[model samples]
Target chain A: MRGRLRRGLLLLVLVGYAAIVVLAAWRHEIRPGWLDAPGAVARGLLAWAGIPPGVAVFTADSASAAEAKIVDLCLEVRVVEADGRVVRLHPDAGERCPAPQPRIWVKGEEIWLDRSAVSLRAAVAARRQELRRGQSARATRLLAEALAAHFRARAHAEGLAPERYALLWAESRVDTNTGERSERDVALMRWGPVGEGDLRVSWRPDASLLESHWPALETP
Target chain B: MSDGSSSYTGQGVLERWLLGPVSLQVMVLNRIVLGGVLFLHAASRAFELPRLYGEAGATWSPAYRAWVDAVLAPDLAAPLLALVAALAELSPEMREVVVIGLYTVLLGSSLAFASGLFTRGAGVVAVVLHMLFVTIHPFAHYGWASLVSPLVLYVVLSRAGDHLSIDAWRRRRRGLAPLPAEAPAWPMRLLQIHIAAMYFHTGFARIDDPLWLEGQALFEALARTLFTRFTFELHVWSPLLVLLTWAVFLLEPLAAIFLWVPRLRTLCALALIAMHVVLEILTNVGWWNFIMIAGLLAFLPPPWVARALPGPVPASR
Candidate 1:
């Protein structure tokens, strides 16, 4: 092909791509819409060709939406031991401890204490209710205090008191329909055991803080 | 007697600029690299076919439907979802078998593409299977995957297999000896344009974000040590983190434009590679950082590539 012809064709294709980007951005929001269509086209072609459907491909928007759904439903809780043998706070029966621990972590002098799974569930539920009520900041504070108490109680039960420990919170969501999983760090809180019913602590909800983690509860 | 050829001065500016002959070495390299990357990508998922794509997989009919409804237009979604629903009706065992078969085709075709054997046919099959994989699971999609999709399609239409390939070697063996080192530049140029647009858009999007503006994005990113390969304590390096943030903002747009400048092209490529390397080190973004760097390789001049890596050097036009 002549260079001029090729360049003209190239120009046409780029303009078309640009148009797609503009349309996608205008309709959906900021994401590059041009990128979304190929997978959709491929899936549509398969369906048209009567081929069996295959694995899923995510667009930015769809993945984010699915992520939001999962976050509302799943929480990943772990307790780190002093010797560095972390335990899964809620492991299904017959499930082995994952070879790799969750990326969500807390720094500073650390200790692990095991507590009642049932109590943690109740506390998480209470926090969820507060979140649904649009009291995200307050709920995060409460959750932090509850986690600190849970650790202190465990220390008391074991007849050992650690000078300090940190709580790592990671949230995960699984799609009910497809079993797709999405997870993110929720928060990390540092707490030091003090006198009875007293604790010194520093807590923050991820880096974006409570607003991003509890987007649903953000003030309109 | 009038000669057929016209004088160079008589040619229009567009003709002069767009019609200039360039080497196809970069295009051929791009073809091989993409084919290899995609083959490994497909092969890696072969064993997990049943769990990730079969009817019994997490992204079954309902999940596929939700995804289509969310991203695709109604006209496109209806047919696609119906097709998914039909496919989802297959028995678990049958779906598993189909998934395995599809991946096998993808692996073979991708290898063929990389080797430049049956180039056109292999390219077609590879692209088709790649798209199916994308449709299989909503959660599996990444930006790099989409970028590769168009690129593979475009290269399929070019003379990407003309050299540095099994096809070339076979032709030489068959008496079409010493294939020309330079092919047309249209395909590689198109790829360059696409890459520039991507960089521009990415940088443009970040221009307004408070986190990016305040140079706190990296600080926030640093705190998420779960994504890092090794522990990196950066509390005392806050100022440097802030400097790196602004550097990213400057480098992206600079790379996008200066990449076309022959004098600055090499530097731009290096800068982009460095940026991606940092991202790879600091975060678990999967194949994204790698693919983006690979995509940028399309911008490299053939002579530079020939000198830098082992391959057939470009022939003068």
Candidate 2:
């Protein structure tokens, strides 16, 4: 082929590639989005006409509405406990808590905040009994705001970039039988051992081989 | 970038790079460049003090290590034992001599691979040692992390030393052949395929992640070194940079396709090269990516490289 024609052909292929990405983006998709389809195309092309390389990678999308709902629930809890008596219970907070030792994603140090950490839970329930507890209502609003910020901050610090992380966090539904010591499934970067009492940490949730080693907790 | 044929009025830049249809010499350079990459990589494993003890210890692992050794026993043993020839071969010799002697054999094996001298022997030795080391630390890293051995091991088997090595020198003295006169092309193409797999799989695995989707992947990557690059310790996000991130994100697989397409092969070569250049500036991917990107030039027509070779060896020679 002539040099000019080859260049033009090259231009056409590049333009075609850019056009496909643009179209995919417009159609609510992008590279690694419609991964299966192009993979199929590439695979078929290769199988029938021989591919240079045989390996390929795959991907999928996940939802975040469930997480947002949970965050909303936490906010509700904050509202339910506002203006209650000072539960000045334990400033000992986490000083006596066991050291967190997650089994996975150990890039740096990590700590966990349990549901029981809410030293004010039962106290608020008692004060919330009165019909016109005006001061307690305001306390509820403050609690809601703090909890919301805590979850968001946790998500961000875990190296989760907003959207997917928030959704996945909510996906990890926190559950308990008698509420004695309920656990929250937390996957984050840490630098040490995660004991049985500490938070659960698993990075590649999809890889069963790995996840099984550091099994993530979940509620049915 | 459009300078493919845009008139070189003075210095002859085009003549130096676009060597018209792929040539035999281009193929040799392709193999040599590939050799440099293989040698450098193997050199690390060979030189690493920590890995030596670690892999040597694994040879005694009661678990799967023994099984792997049983299968490739001979291939897995000789050079590895040679690596441990650390025992003073000559007691009369100085400790520095021992160090230098071990290093000489190690370096010679690497150079043999790099220069394609007795490459099959060198390459085999390289793989055997690599297998032994990795088998021990299979927990420390994954097989994907050591992806190059199988690819260059292909070169060693193809008798790459026949053209570009001291082995080739020995061959020349024996009066067998003038190195076939035409370069074999499939091995390079095979290599290009291998690298494309690495990039595609890497990108594919991270596709669903929010950072890659929002184009913050590159930003986070830049952020690792962001605190130092600027005078002000700044964190500014630009819409334009994000758009560029998306552009490159979509380009890797596209470049792979272009490299395969014969008509646009040169264009693809340049695009991929530029991609690596940008990657080099933005990340610390090491010579792995850069060398692979440069080596992708093989897909271009030989004439492209034909135009690229020097007019003469230069009278200084």
Candidate 3:
């Protein structure tokens, strides 16, 4: 009789538990709004536990603009200024900025951005396809380098002396799932006086960035 | 003690079907493995506490906040929101230090639970800490964590420290006889149902997607080399990829049901384990595959565990 009682109670609890799991799955797949009640209960528990609530939401079009938002990652940037004023420039409307994401590292002079989201083949294919179709004449280019060049061209169009401002290469990516903006410095190149300069760009390896960020990454 | 009905007749057929004798060893083994998984899970995230949870961390997602505000009562959301707001006042260095400190506490609690030292208290604290950590960041939490959260809750309700643990060893040293090796059937039953339900829901969910139906889901997933162990340039193998995709889709619901059958249970368990292993190798799902593998271990009968250990099995009380 006792054994039967134990089994009965265990069965009861297990069924109750299973009901909750199945109901949750159903809610998640079918009636997601139903979860709000439980979520509210949980939040109340968390509130009772003394966790603060607030969302981290911000926008960044340039590396300097992302400085205050750099949380757990280290970003290195060399901003170029003319006459103590930042050569502020924005991307053309609807174009993704070339600013790097929050996670980046500096190796000597070159900054390597973590491009985990983009494949080299895809980037190369997009670039080739754009050029092949003569779509480069369009207002937008999907290639990062091409987008950076457009921004640099914009800076020149603003009448800033080329030699007076260092070229800031912002590596930016909007997270596809969340639409969150993350931008940082990829590479910065110094130029000579306007109309008398040869372009030389520095390239860094993906693994090299790991070495620079390892120390800070140890705790974060 | 009777609630006005005989124990046999009062319980419905469904109740009798659900309740049965299960090997205690299965529950104990699950407790140990699940605890270890939880420890490792917490440890891995400890390294990213600041970016995941602190003020200086990634943007506090608006979507995450809105969901919390809308679903949660204001009283509950207020304190949580207040805590998040308070982080802004801390200096960056101080914030990092505090985040590190919190992660350390979580890790230590997890370790204690895994080792079965003060199992109930430590396990309870660990579960609470884990739930809090889950709430801290939208990105930091994942499906595997959510799945394990309930098991951890069950762990606290269990006499999981009765065997294969520091608590058990100490009890033996103090002249107490060890608990009978066989555990009540409910824990394993709960786990079995949980796994089946997961597969059932997910399997059904995938069938509705055109990608799975058309057989391009696995192939498209494999094309992204980031998650896979290797890349194949085999354009000719599209048919095989589709077959593999259908196999997964069919196997899930089948396994969920057949896992309860005596004749088919072992086969289903083995196949499910293989699926998880193949998925693990083919994808970069982190601890998810490991968690599933551990959960699957409950399918092993208690006799297997008892035969391997040195102690003679105590007669069922």
Best model number under lDDT: 1
The superposed Cα distance between candidate 2 and the true structure at residue A185, in angstroms, equals 17
Candidate 3 residues B53-157, lDDT tens each? Answer: 755454344433433432232323344355655654577678667766767777877787877788888888777667656655533454576677777766666
* Cα misplacement distance, residue A192 of candidate 1 (Å): 16
Q: Can you write out model 3's per-residue Cα lDDT over A78-187, one digit (the tens) per residue?
A: 22344444332222222233333222232222234333321223223323423333332110112333323322333434544443323333334445445555754433
Give the poorly placed runs of model 1, Cα more than 4 Å off.
A1-220, B1-11, B16-19, B55-57, B61-83, B315-317
lDDT tens digits by residue: candidate 2, A165-207: 1111101121222222222222221111123111122232122
What DockQ, on C-alphas, does every prediction get?
0.05, 0.03, 0.13
Q: How well is candidate 1 docked (DockQ)?
A: 0.05
Q: What is residue A155's positional error in candidate 2, in angstroms?
A: 15
Deviation of model 2 at A147, angstroms: 20
lDDT of 1 by residue, A35-72 (tens): 66776777668767865332233332234443334233
lDDT of 2 by residue, B13-76 (tens): 3322332222344445544665565456546655554333332332223322322222222222
Worst 10 residues of 3 chain B by lDDT: B66-75
Question: TM per model?
Answer: 0.61, 0.46, 0.61
The local distance difference test score of each candidate is 0.58, 0.40, 0.54
Where does the lowest 10-residue lDDT sum fall in candidate 1 chain B?
A: B1-10
Q: Which structure among the candidates has the greatest TM-score?
A: 1
